[model samples]
Target: MVMGIQQVSLSADGHRAAVVSLRDGVPSIYLIKNPFERRLVSDTLAPTVWAQRRLRQVPRLAPALALASEALRQRNPFLRDASYTTPPAGPLLAASEPAGSNGTNGHGEAPDSTRYGTLRVDFRNYVFSSAFDEARPPRATPSYYSSDPFAPKDNVDENGRYRPRRYRLYFTPDLVYGAAGYDMLYGVQSVTQMMFSDMLGNHRIWAATNLLVDLRNSDYLIAYSYLPRRTDWTVAVYHVARLLPDYALRTLYRYRHYGLNLSASYPLNKFERFDFGLAYMGVNQTDIGNLARPPVTRTLFYPSITYTRDVSVPGLLAPIGGHRLALQLSGSPGNLLYGRQIRFVTLLADARTYTSFGRGLYSFAFRLAGGASFGPNPQLFYSAGVENWINRRFDSFPIEDLTDFVFATPVLPLRATDINTLKGPYFGLFNAEFRFPLVAALLPGPLPILPLYNLQGTAFLDAGAVWGSPSNRRLNLFRRDEHGRQVLDDLRVAGGLGLRTIILGFPFRFDFAWPFDGRRFLHRRFYFSVGLDF
Candidate 1:
C-alpha cells in the first residue's frame, strides 16, 4: 500500500508522521496520526489541486515594492529572480485554506500573504542558538554564494574568510558577525558590545567601547576566545573609568583602571557547565573637590570559579521553561600573589525558573539571588533601581565599594527608590513575574519600522532586603534605625507591569511601578530598559 514512498518524516513523540509519495509521476503529501489513521493531504484533492499548480513558480522572497521595482533589481541585480507573476502552489507549512480565502490568495494559503515581510534590523541572539554554525549532518552539503560581493562579484576576502551579507544567515563561514547591542544608562553609559565567531565556532572575538558621548571619559575592551572541543578559553584586556558614591560618608570617588583576564568554561553535561577565571586589575583614584584627600591607587589579583546548571529553553522573547542555578566563589588575593594588601573572598548563589502556559503566549518566571563576603573588604551591594534601567536617576545616597570598585553587586527592581540609595554588605532578592504575548505575527508589505513580533506584557512583584551596614559592622536587621524602627521592618517591596518589544533589533521594555508595603501604595515609578528578563 505504501511502496512508492519518496520521503517520510516522523514526529518527535513517534505518534505522528508525514509521508511524501510519487503518484502518477507526481509528488503527493499525506499525514498519519495515532490509531494508524492515514489522511490524504494533497493528491489532486478538491477544487484546488496539484494538477492546477504551475510547473515553475517562484516564492515571494521580498516585498511587493522591492520585487516590482526596476531600480532595486538594477542595484541588487541578484534580486531580479525574486519577482513572481504567476501563482505558485500552496506553502509547505500552510494548512488547507478557509472556505473563501483560497480564491484571492493565489500564491499560498497564508492570510493576507503577510509572512514574507523583511526585517529592519539584525538581532544577534547570543543564547540558545550556537554562536557558531552547527556541525553539518552526513548529507550532500553544497556551498552557495549566499553573501553579497563587497566588490563586484567577489565574495572571498584577502584572508579567505567569507562573511555572509545577512548576519542571521548561518553557513560554513570563515567569520560571522553578531551584535549584542547597546545598553543605555543615563549619566553612566550608552555602551555597545559586538561579537563575532567563525562558522564552526573554533574562534570568537569580542569588542566593547564607549560611543564617544563623553569627551573626557572613555572605555575600551577587547577579547578573543578559542571555543573548539569541549573546553573554551578566552583572554580579555580592558581600560575603564569608574565612579563610586558613598552615601553614608557623603562623597564621590572616581577611579581609572586597567586589567587583563583569562577565563575558561567547560560543559560538565547536557545541563551543567564549569568555569574558571583569573584576572589582574589596577585602579588610580583622582579628582576630589574641596576635600584634599591623598591620591589613592591599588592593584589586585582575582581568581574565581563558577558552577552553573542551565536547563531552561529559549522562547520568542525569553526563556520559557525549566530552571537554572549558578554558584560562584571569587577572591582577590593581592596580599598573597601581588603583595598589594587588597584581599577578600566572596560567595554568591542565583536561581531562576520559568514555566509556560501554552504556545509561549503566556509564562511565569521566578528568580532568587543572594550573596555574602569575608575578609577586610567584602563585596559591596548596590540595592537600587531595576536592571538596565534607562535614564536612571539617583539621589545622594551612600554606597561604599571597599573592593576597589570591583566585585560590586547592583541588585535590582527595588522600586520607590533611587540608584545608590540603599547601602549594605549582605543582600537578598526575589522576583515573580507573569509574561503574556500580545501580537506575535508579521505585517504585510515593506515597512520602515522594525516588525513588532512577540510584543509582550509583564506583571511582576519584587521583594528584597539589604542588611549589615558598614558603619556599625552589625546586622541592620536587629538594630534600630534613626527612625526608631527595626531595619528589617523596612524591607523593600515593589510591583509593576511592563510592555516588551523589539526596537532597532533589541528587546526594549517600559515599566511602571509603585511601592506596596501591605498597607498602602507609594509614589508611582517609571523606567525604560533594554534586554530580556532573568
Candidate 2:
C-alpha cells in the first residue's frame, strides 16, 4: 500500500480534485489529445499516461474546412459538430466559427480529404460561380462561365448525381368516396400505348417526394395531385427547397402562389464559390364560379439570378463532368392583363457539357445547345446530340438541330401573316439518339436465378424538323405524301431494331421501334416498350 502525489491542475471551474497518500487509488490524471484533436481531460488511474494537450489552436488551414465537412457527410448524415467545455488554461474565443440554428455559420467537421467535381448549369438551372479571368470578356449579349477551375471551393452538386439520399414512394388507391373528398383520376391514357393498363376506376390518389439533402447540402422536392371533377374539384401542390450548406434559400409554393429565393456566398480560396441570388415569382388563379362570377385572371412576377460552378477536371473515364456554365436575367411586368416580359439566359456553355467518354472498355455521352432570344420576340438557337454505350452498341434518339418561331399562343400554332414572310426562327430537327449493347459484357459468370441474362441488342435512328414559310401561302396547312411533296418542309427519319428481353422476376425490358421515312401507316410504325428503346 504505497502512494505519493506531487501536483495536479485544472480548476478554474473545469473541475478536478485528486490527492494521494493512504493506499494507491488516488494518484490519477487524464488529458488526452491527439491523432487530430480528441480533447479529453480527467482523473484516470494512470492506464499509461503521456501529457501534452493542444487540440486545434487555429491558425487557419483546417484541411479546407475538413474537405467541406466531408462533402456534407457524404450526402447528409444529419450533420453534427458542436460540443463545448473548456476553461482550464484559458485563452480562447474569437476565431469562433460553428453556428447553425438558422443563423448558420461555417465549417462543421467530418472531412479528412476529397476531390471530384463538376456542377454547372445553363439549361435554366442558372449558376455561374467564378468569372474565370482568362482575359476574355468582349461580347455584350451572351454570357455563361464555369468549367472546372479545379472543383472544391466547398464542393456542391446537389444530386444531379454524386449519389445518396435517393427516395421515391408511390401508392395509388382507388375505390370510391365522394362528398368533398377522395375521388381522384389522372390523365394520360396510352400516349401510343405499349400496354400497361388496368385503367382503374375514378377514385384515386398520388404522392411523390425526393430528398437529396447535403452534398452541397439541403435540397427537397415534393409533388401532390388530387381530383374530383363532375363539376369542379382539383388540388395540386409542388414544392422545392434548397439551403445548400453555405448560402441559398430556395422556396417555391404552388398553391397560394408564391416563390421566393435568396442566396449569398463568397469563397475566394479552396477553388471557388461565389454565389448570388435574389428572386421573386408570383402566380395566382381564382374561379369558384357562380358567386356573382368575377375573378377570371391572376398574376405573375419574376426577378432572377443564377451563377453556378463546381469543377474538377482530369478524366479518361468515370468522371468527365457537366454544366460548364449558366447565366440568367429575367424581367416581367405587363399591363392590360400581361404582356411585357424579358429574358436573357444562356446555359451549358460549350454545348451543354454532358461529356462522358471512356476507353479501355468504351463509353460515350454527348450534348448540344446554342443560344439567342433577345427582347420582344427575337430568336436564334441550336441543339445537337450523341450518346453511346460500347458493350451495347446501336440505339438512337439524338436528332436535335432547332430553330424557332411560328407561334400564335393559346397552345402553339404556326402563325405568319407577312412581315416579310416572317422568315424569322430558322433551323430544324432538334433531337436524335443511338445506342447498342449486345450481351451483358459478353458474360462468363453468374446465372442461377439468371442474374446476368446476357445478350442485349438494339439499332435505331429518329428525327425532327421545323423551318418556316407560309404568309398568305397555305398549301392546306402542310403535310402531303405520295409525291404531293410539302411535308412540313421535310427532314424526318426513323429506323429500327429489337430483342432486348433480359427478363426474370423482372428488372424487365422489352423494346421494339421502327419508323423509317414518314407518311401514314403512322409512317412505317412498330413500337413496344417497358424501358430502353432510346
lDDT of 1 by residue, 10-72 (tens): 898878888898766678888878625646565542321222234334432334333346776
Candidate 1: count of backbone clashes, pairs at least 3 residues apart or interchain: 4
Please list the C-alpha lDDT of all candidates, in the order they appear. Answer: 0.67, 0.31
Instruction: For residue 348, give model 2's deviation from the true position in Å.
Output: 24
Clashes of each: 4, 36
**Residue-by-residue lDDT tens digits, candidate 2, 1-534:** 334555544445544444334345655544322312435574343211011113322223233233345555334312212112221132221123443344222232222211122322122333666667655785543122235444423344575544333233434444222211110011111111011112332223333333344322222222222223322222323333221111122322111233444444444444444444444433332222232534222233333444445453433212244434444443333222463343333221222233334431222323332223344433332212111111121121111111121111010011111012123223222222233345563343565454445444434344433233234222232466678865533343445554454444322333343433344323333332233321
TM-score attained by model 1: 0.61
Candidate 2 segments whose C-alpha is farther than 4 A from its true place: 1-206, 214-226, 231-233, 241-459, 465-499, 502-534
Against the true structure, candidate 2 has what lDDT?
A: 0.31
Per-model TM against the reference: 0.61, 0.22
